[model samples]
Target: MEILKGIVLLLLVLVGFTMFSLKMPKGMKAMGALAGAATASFLVEAFHFYVGGDLFGITILRDLGAASGGMGGVAAATLVALALGSSPVYAVLIGCAVSGFGILPGFFAGYVLGFILPKMEEKIPDGIDLIAVIVIAAPLARLVAIGADPLVNATLINIGKIITQATAQSPTIMAIILGGVITVVATAPLSSMALTAMLGLTGLPMAIGALSVMGSSFMNAVFFHKIFKDKSTTIAVAVEPLTQADLISANPIPVYCTNFVGGAIAGLIVTHFGLINNAAGTATPIAGLMVMYGFNSPLKVTIAAALCAVAGLTIGFIGSLVFKNFKIKSVAEVRGTV
Candidate 1:
């Protein structure tokens, strides 16, 4: 109940900020205004922490997601989709299932169309138009649902029981393995980055992870993708808009590619150097200064995580490059997917 209240109150503040700030125009200055609004939201949340109250989502705002209603952005997206052409069931799936993570998958799926639209030539040729749209939507829908379903379901539904029972003891290896598995499983068809966040925090690793990335929803996806990588969305479509909004994607490719390298490093170093992060928030390249406070300490852990992050970034860059090389080109190419 308290968590619910905090989420609601915080959202009210966000709504006020958005209305006041939205009128400031649309370029960089508007961006600064948005940042200011986000900062205000950040302070309000911090104030909640000071009062010994839970923000219901301190990590989202405190890190970089702007605010933490957690369910609104995607709902807005679904509304837009409904207004566009989606059915009620689809809209509900998108709204309830998606969070900020929708950006990448949605963009990727849409990118297919982005590319496809140009070459389509005059009216989309009747019967093929609907077929084309459906084709584009399949990958988009799969990935979007996968990214949203788990996290949205975690504590809200009874499904987390499966994870809870498995990791009840909370061993370090279990945490790592589970983290890796959930992230991988989080791939389209049946996964959610949100569920991974809840599952990733168990007995031994709860504190360390929340401090490192798990705590902040912004950092969670950033770091997760740092490990895996995205596929469903091309960078051109997915990266531009949301990056403007300051949201990250939950695509597994980046997370897997990066985290494994970093985690492997952490795995080797965790026992020997006794790596520890006490603060509960996401630590990114910008958040590096928390060193004295013990984030990414042991140097090796930080280094490892960095290596992991770089690995994902590199892989994503390369995958994108390779695709572009093959002349796959933009969302217009086959409506954006195979």
Candidate 2:
């Protein structure tokens, strides 16, 4: 109880600090608000896990996934809702639906939905910056996803099982790798994070870890590539939102080319390392990393992350070249003609 109170106080302080920061001319309001809320949410969920585990049946790991996913979902839902002139209730309902099964899904349910809802939002007269609305929704998104996960899980599992049975292989990759792919496969209509979380539940962290090791520089490459190769102001801001799809949408050839190189390198390193995703519901390397940072397999985990970076960078480099030869120029052209 004492620990819980301390945590609450800390979170409240962070929130208050963030609120105050928003008044500053140089302070980044969105990032500050998110940091504050995330700190609070993290503390709240952590306490729930530490103290309430026996009583509430919450695992610290899963709880992390739920909280983060819920936060992302709520934010995304609210953004989509505001952008599309829909009710927050409905947006949150769908956000929960996106959070199906595990933590990654919970987080991503909102992300993919943000993309999907923009078209609808564009239909409305008073639509706003989808990202801004998402910023508003960020804190509560994960909670919404957590609340809606049971229904989402049931439906996703049925679908995953059916797809697995129908197809020879399932697209079950870990949080980062799979998340990267989902980030690429913009039209697949799958929730990237949600799918990754479900896969995580099946105990594939080693594989994911391996890939992360293999593609450690994937995000880094994104950073470098944007700084070097990308020529657009609108698309260059990839790291801020952690979105490659938007880049692809803005300048498809460069992004597409980058994906192939990045993905291939990632696949090779992951397969070579024989590492798999840890069996957490949300397979973000960050999550497993936090849990086992100083644990028994720290070195191996680090290696796996390095490989993931390699995978993403190598694939991005090569894929970008390939994009130059592709039939379409802009992502809009690719989609519009299709």
Q: In terms of lDDT, which candidate is strongest? A: 2
User: What tens digits encode model 1's per-residue C-alpha lDDT throughout 243-332?
Assistant: 312122233344344433333333332323344432222222222213212333346555545544454344345444433333222233
The reply for model 1, stretches above 4 Å from the true place, is: 1-172, 185-193, 196-204, 207-273, 277-301, 310-338
Candidate 2: segments with Cα more than 4 A from true spot: 1-83, 86-154, 159-180, 186-191, 198-202, 205-244, 250-254, 271-296, 320-338
After TM-score superposition, the amount by which residue 192's alpha carbon in candidate 1 deviates from its true location, in angstroms, is 6.6
Q: What overall lDDT goes with each candidate model?
A: 0.34, 0.40
lDDT (Cα, tens digit) per residue for candidate 2, span 72-102: 4344444444333345654665555444233
Report, for all candidates in order, the number of backbone clashes: 28, 61
Indicate the residue-level lDDT of 175 in model 2: 35
* Residue 103 shift from truth in candidate 2, angstroms: 8.8
What's the lDDT for candidate 1? Answer: 0.34
